[model samples]
Target: MNTPAALTLEAPAEHPFAPFVRILGKGKRGARNLTREEAREAMGMLLEDKVEDTQLGAFLMLLRHKEESAEEMAGFTEAVRERLTAPAIQVDIDWPTYAGKKRHLPWYLLAAKCLAQNGVRIFMHGGGAHTAGRLYSEQLLDALAIPLCRNWQSVNEALDTGNLAFMPLQDWAPHLQRMIDLRNTLGLRSPIHSLARILNPLGARCGLQSIFHPGYQSVHREASSLLGDNSIVIKGDGGEVEINPDTLSHLYGTTAGVGWDEEWPALSARRHVKPASLQPEHLLALWRGEVEDSYPQLALLSTMALALRGLGTPREQAFEQAQRFWDNRDTSI
Candidate 1:
């Protein structure tokens, strides 16, 4: 085991991250979960930037390979929940979106439009290239011509107007945001990539998350089983809200009870519809109105409506509502 390093008063100073680091490096499968206090302390150290890069690097890898326990994930989530920026329209919208990023742009845009149109008010938070999810959202938005929102005011206005609003993750949490650098430097994702997705910037109860990375799916599911009280989770193309047309997308959420019709779309049913494809850049250029709607849009409208419960609308009824929006020409968010 490695000796305990001197910890600064940042993320996990009070916790025994060094021991976990040793255990992880040794290739041990599952050892023990971190206590709530320990997880909170580690997050504090991380936020304060007091943890050494080597130790921090090990910390992320340990979680990646060793996998954090649900209890530990809960503790970490609680700490994040404590340190987030409150939503612009906090008490107004019961369901605020903790947005996920995926390479496909049309799906999230459609989901956001459907959710907003159906009154599942959301505050979509994101950033640039931190992971696959955010990178895709950024790329698509660049092509779509949609405005990139910078602060709470713009997001608040959009949500209030029954449309989606966004805030970049880097702007929300700089310390956590900095972890993305390790990806390019190290040439692989670390645990911070996992935690970043589960972040609750607005501290809202409902979050719409994507499960893209297969390795982290279980980690995410375990975490949700612990801290998820009000959230909507779906299997997206790469973890955003958009379901792949070639695969069935399931809602693996612990929040809101799933109605009969809201169950995950079967692979057979999902693969049944093969919408025509267009070049990514070409589709994006037209998505922004730089061109026109010549590309077939990826569909996630039904999955989205199913996740939010449609404000008490019956599952089937909610689906119908989603269908209409999907078919509508003004479906751009």
Candidate 2:
């Protein structure tokens, strides 16, 4: 009796995404950064949800550990941009606000409002509050009466009517928004945080990014250059695009495929103290001229100057024009 023939079983096949994980996570001597093409493919898989949960977590954390390079960021941005379906809307500036403010109110919102009131079309996007203890821009939109656009159609309408619109990442890129929401589970920020800032989905003429980390300003600048995007990267107040009034800020940027750097001097000689709590209502009050705070005033004007410079205004003229826009703003909103 040939006893039951010796049993044979087939081994499981390797996953398609395993190669990307190995490319990033292979041991110290073997691991290396992904090429731009490889990064584009990897990010495409992520956006398509073609990878497993375990693989997703590992890939994200490994990228976080290595800190994304400009090539990787550019490729990832390309993947995301490829998936965007919004038609071009003739926006003058592309503003990304991911880092919620902890040290001060979001003065940049008022600056954008001032510009919009003066005929500059601005497209702003953000991820809603995923991290606790910070005030997010979306939370204050109601106070400012800025329409929170829920779809591309609404965004187009808002831009046409008011020259400004704010959209949350969830509305446009739900997969990426889900990845950002994993901050609690992952216990660290992922490359998605940086990648989202450079998307510039509508192909706006100017992309403005604010990063808190020291070296990331260069990464953003170079990546924007690679993408042929005219962009400015700043280490702004609380990591939002709003310039701080009390300290000097460095602006790293790329224009027409060339990189440049600028130093913006402090607006005030004395450092302002952080507020105990951020009041959303104060934004409306300040816009309406009911509040008189020097800190927010300078913060708003200086932030607008950065954007104005991005729009081709000369440096001195940018500051003067920003102040004029603020003074001439229609405050009855």
Candidate 3:
């Protein structure tokens, strides 16, 4: 008699992405972080939309649980850089502003404006307001009058005219932006949040990153070093790259492929109270000299100093130069 039809078919072939998931979820004794090459391949596939939804979720969560290593971060960044279709705009600084402000205003914007006014070519990129109750950079773009670039041509023009520009993550890397959008679905931030900070898409000479969580400063530092990136990572106010003038801040970074750490003293003796409300107009007022708040002034100066330091100025000289930039600002806003 002929064999039953149920036994005639073969099982489906395993997904190529399955091995990556298995490598991460192979139980306590077997699971480990992906090597740099493996991470690059995995991220390459993810960016190409070759990974399934289930596999993507699993890989993100697994990596999130274990926390991504420096190798993984560097490798993932490499994959992203390879896919970026950036123009030949010469950028002096790569500033990634992912975290919006909750308690304090984004004093860092003023710092960037100050630098831009003095001819530092700054490229700032960020995501939309994924979380509630926080004021994102894009929301204040109109008030700040900073150019919002939609494409590389616009970015090139903005930099040439104003020495600064802001681009949204979705405009350049939609796949990574989609992963970030899954914050609500995943109930936690995926590694994309951190990886995006290190992308420096135009290959700027200096990169600045801010991490809110403890211990991530070192991760960024090491990852930047591995990528040969001259970068600074700090636990800044509200998780943006604005320094808090009320408390001492620790900066972790790499310069010329060498890792180093520094401590910047607080500008104020006591911590400043959080603002009752965050007003986007206040940023304009502060820049135009209509407002004279000591807290924000110190914040702007210190934040600019940090950026200057990243641009290779010595610590003392950076602080002095930042003060000069603030004092000599156009204040025409």
Q: Give lDDT tens digits, candidate 2, residues 1-333.
A: 567888799999999999999998998999998888899999999999899999999999999998889999989998888889987688999999999998799989999999999988999999989899999999988878788999999999999999999999999999999999999999998888888889999888899999889999998999999989999999988888899889998989799879998898888988988788888888889999998999999999998999999988877999999999988888997
Give candidate 1's whole-model lDDT. 0.57
lDDT (C-alpha, whole model) for all candidates: 0.57, 0.91, 0.92
Q: Whole-model lDDT, candidate 3?
A: 0.92
Count of steric clashes across candidates, in order: 14, 0, 0
- Once fitted onto the true fold, the runs of candidate 3 whose alpha carbons sit more than 4 angstroms away are 1-6
lDDT score, candidate 1, position 164: 58
CA RMSD (A), model 2? 1.0
RMSD of 1: 7.4
TM-scores for every candidate against the unseen true structure? 0.74, 0.98, 0.97
lDDT string for model 3 (1-333, tens) is 988777577899999999999999999999999999999999999999999999999999999998999999999999999988997789999999998999988989989999999999999999999998988999988778899999999999999999999999999999999999999999998989999898999999899999889988899899999999899999999889999999999999898769999999888988888779987788888888887998999999999999899998998999999999999999885
State residue 267's C-alpha deviation in candidate 1, in Å.
Answer: 7.9
Best-first order by TM-score: 2, 3, 1
Clashing pairs in 2: none
